[model samples]
Target: MQIRRVLAATSAAVIAATGLVACSSDSSDSASGDSESSEQDGPIRVGTTDAAKKAWAVLEEQAEAAGLDIEIENFADYSTPNQALEQGQLDTNNFQHLKFLAEYNVGNDSDLTPIVATEIIPLALFWKDHDSLDGIEGESIAIPNDPSNQGRAINVLVQADLITLKEEGLVTPTPADIDTEASKVQITPVDAAQTPSAYGEGTPAIINNSFLDRAGIDPNLAVFQDDPNSPEAEPYINAFVVRAEDADNETIKKLAELWHSPEVQAAVDEDAKGTSVQVERTQEELQEILDRLEEAERNS
Candidate 1:
């Protein structure tokens, strides 16, 4: 895949650039307190887990050409970016999907909002021993144990016709929801980081895209994946998020829209290794999805 080619050619460059910023320290001071007054005070601090990706550099260049200054802060893990943004340390972040954001918002009593849709990096089912879903029956599959990804992994199995859920239309179904008597395979929930290892252990696994590169798994080798364009996949769409008060800020909105620029999008496509399916949802539509997810989280 193109991801392999990019990694081989620019792994060193990526590593070097990755050192540019560590995760920002937590602060008791709420940065959101002064957000409105300081909206244009300095470079728009945009937090991301993929700061080393070529797309950020291209995005910076494009934003500069358009008279907007953006500073990309790299976070080592998934939990910090929104925290940084909520605390007023960052003007925006572009690392998580709507479901993840909803969980964070509902859990923390925060109102970080999605400004625009970016792309969906598909969660795919990989099997080392089986060439197709038909090759496995009454066998076990490993899925992510985290709330956000586990539900999606279960949905992937359902989509592949390997499992049947007891009820339909669940936003985040768990293994307990599966009808074991009717299903083709049982599931073993494991840490998201262990899915590739589970695959190596000769069990079929549904792996997240972020773990694929480091595990030396080719995305194209996956036997099945959820459809990114489907209505069921809306919650998984990643976006550039900001504090709710700044959702309509012209500069931040423009910065979010800049992700669709040809140069930036091309760079994103290369960095994603062709797993990213581009999505273009209006801000209102994105918020609608987020609201539904937040409601689901509250109910869950």
Candidate 2:
């Protein structure tokens, strides 16, 4: 979408210093703006966490060939991208899944919506000393502390039989919901970024795929992981997100659809090391899933 040009030529150095990379120079004058009245003539300022991945380069090339301009803004943490998108600093973002998006929208009273389904990266459990989930009774396992991911991590433990929840079929089980006496291991919640370090410190951790690559841990070495193809994994399907007002923008939709291009998909596969399960869902289907998740979040 065409946004107001907020950054002048002099700010390019500062933007680069903060990790915002422009995928194309054609729309250098276009950066940030109001989503309501703008046309799709300028660069689509897209925010993401994995901007360094080669898939972005491929997608940029594909978008250029398709007559669309996109700018990639990189954020260091998971929380900032959506906030940026909500604040109108970004035209769209593709960093989080529907569950996380639901939590953000419900918690903050925002209406950021998903436009296209991307891929589901499995959350895996890894350990430094143990090769299998055997004989690890009484030990503690670290999990992500964020609301959405923490629940998924708890589910991973439940699937591994290392822990059991007090209630059956809880969608987002917290550590408090764990049946401590009945469970084999204790639950420790930490920041998502520190999970690998927790693993390095001799604790078993359910690490997100983003941290595994940078930590030099092999995805194949994960002792256990949730099944991406299962029905329970529906909420974890990542997608391109935008404000509710811009959800139907044709240019943004076209840009989001480019993620499935053969060249871009290949780059994504190479970057994910065969661990990512690509997902396809219509915008209506995705909105329905998000609605259900948002209802759950509200009820919780």
Candidate 3:
């Protein structure tokens, strides 16, 4: 997303299973050249918060299958998309978690909703061969300093048994939550996107799939990541978000239908090469996940 503004301190935590406004994969570049020009009235304009262009290759196929053409637009930041959409700049947009979308609507007065889910890409924990999370004592454990995603990244560590929290911390957890005086490893929070590259200092770094993918490191290299079956999987999973009024819109439905098709799921596995896997959930299931995430954020 070539954001005119870098949005704000994510009003939410960094990496609970549900992804926030920022996505590191699909570089912040223009959507593929495959798009038809924007002037045509038959093509619908779809805006995205991240590098949706890459995944949008599939979207293009979906549109073709549905007998509609589209002009894909990309945005880097999570904030203000509703304003862009409601203002009629885009026919639809697919970015930000439903929670972020809900918060955006509450904060900005719009009625956006999800037509369906696409895929949930998990944020992974990468480290040099430290053997196991158990033996890496008295070492540096790098997380993010960003208020939105830091704690979510750390929770990955806790889930992997690398560290324990005195209690679950806020949207972003500070080092103090680690019982720093007694913890085996020294905890340090780096910038969210910088953690993957921060591995050279002999500390294990936690990063999201987008950052890790952008860094070109193999996902298999990561010592730990969220399990697909784990309770923490919801936040990391993503969806095709839209306006509430378009909940029944054919274009949006066709786009989601294409994504949920078995063919697309197989493509996600092949395209991601096993690094980032996709998930299937019903509309009701997506709603439940959103409710659970809100509950977790409230609890955190």
Candidate 4:
């Protein structure tokens, strides 16, 4: 997140060069030291985009029992939490997966680190008025159109043997990757959030767990889903992230521990309602996946 401050200052300089007045701030010095005090007397500000406050009540209670003040800040957008963490506004965030964090770091030239692996929310293929994949063989299927999720949608289809990507080991595959002649379903790329509503007779779609929850759709209705235990699911595994310097911090480590406890696991299960699988990938394995993702990002 050191790079956030640098980018801001760089923008200010550019504005000044263009004969524009630039606002200034005196908090840069203090921002750099904020993470160091996350576990001190002050409360630890945890960032998340999901139902962390509602789903992780036991985590809060456990942290309180351990004398650690916890503040869960729920974000509507995925990008802001990382920006906040980088600028020292948050001690750590728990919303994004390895590939997402890797892309953020690569795009911003920062060294944000993933300290723990949490759960793998599978993007499942669901259909309306159809019970099986074969019933919707020649139908048009909708998938997310975004760069990050589009590949994920395609992967689900590929696993179902409905389509095949032209290249293997793609981190983010667009519709271009699909081999049209070989594919059984006609791939229709739509907004990720729109996939849930796109389903009907002769129409199937890949729906992400988050969006499906928001739309009140049941994931049990899915015809196909990616295997969470497979190595291919590594990139989509979510984690707790922090600035690289605070990777060894005791508070963050304890928080990760509390997340994997039985109470928290029960909460995750209750909240997910069988939509996602809870994963307990080790810290070393997480870093290895992150490194591999970062390498792939750089090459891309």
lDDT of 3 by residue, 264-295 (tens): 66666655657655666777787676666555
The alpha-carbon deviation from the true structure for residue 124 of candidate 2, after best TM-score superposition, in angstroms, is 0.6
lDDT of 1 by residue, 1-300 (tens): 000011112232453455333223432232434444434545677888767789888888888888886677776677777776876667789989999999999999999999989999988999995667777788799999999999999999999999999998887998889999999999999999999999998999999887887688888889999999889999999999988878767778888899999899899888877788889999999999999999989988
Regions of candidate 3 where Cα sits further than 4 Å from its true position: 1-42, 49-54, 80-83, 98-111, 129-131, 168-176, 200-202, 291-300
Which lDDT value does model 4 have at 172?
Answer: 78
What TM-score against the true fold does each predicted structure earn? Answer: 0.86, 0.87, 0.73, 0.85
The lDDT, on a scale of 0 to 1, for candidate 1 is 0.82
lDDT of 2 by residue, 1-300 (tens): 222223223233454467543445533333333345446755788888877888988888888888786777777667777766765567789989999999999988998999999999999999887789887788888999989999999999899898899998888999889989899999889998899999999999999989988988888888899999998999999999988878777788888999999999999999989898899999999999999999999999
Residue 282 CA error for candidate 1 (Å)? 0.8
CA RMSD of all predictions? 6.5, 5.1, 9.1, 6.5
Which lDDT tens digits does candidate 4 get at residues 46-73? 7777744345677777777766666666
- Total backbone collisions for each predicted model: 2, 1, 12, 0
In model 1, which runs have C-alpha deviations exceeding 4 angstroms? 1-39
Clashes of 3: 12
After best superposition, candidate 3 residue 107: deviation in angstroms?
4.8
Error of 4 at 97 (Å): 1.0
Clashes of 2: 1
Where does candidate 2 stray beyond 4 Å?
Answer: 1-39
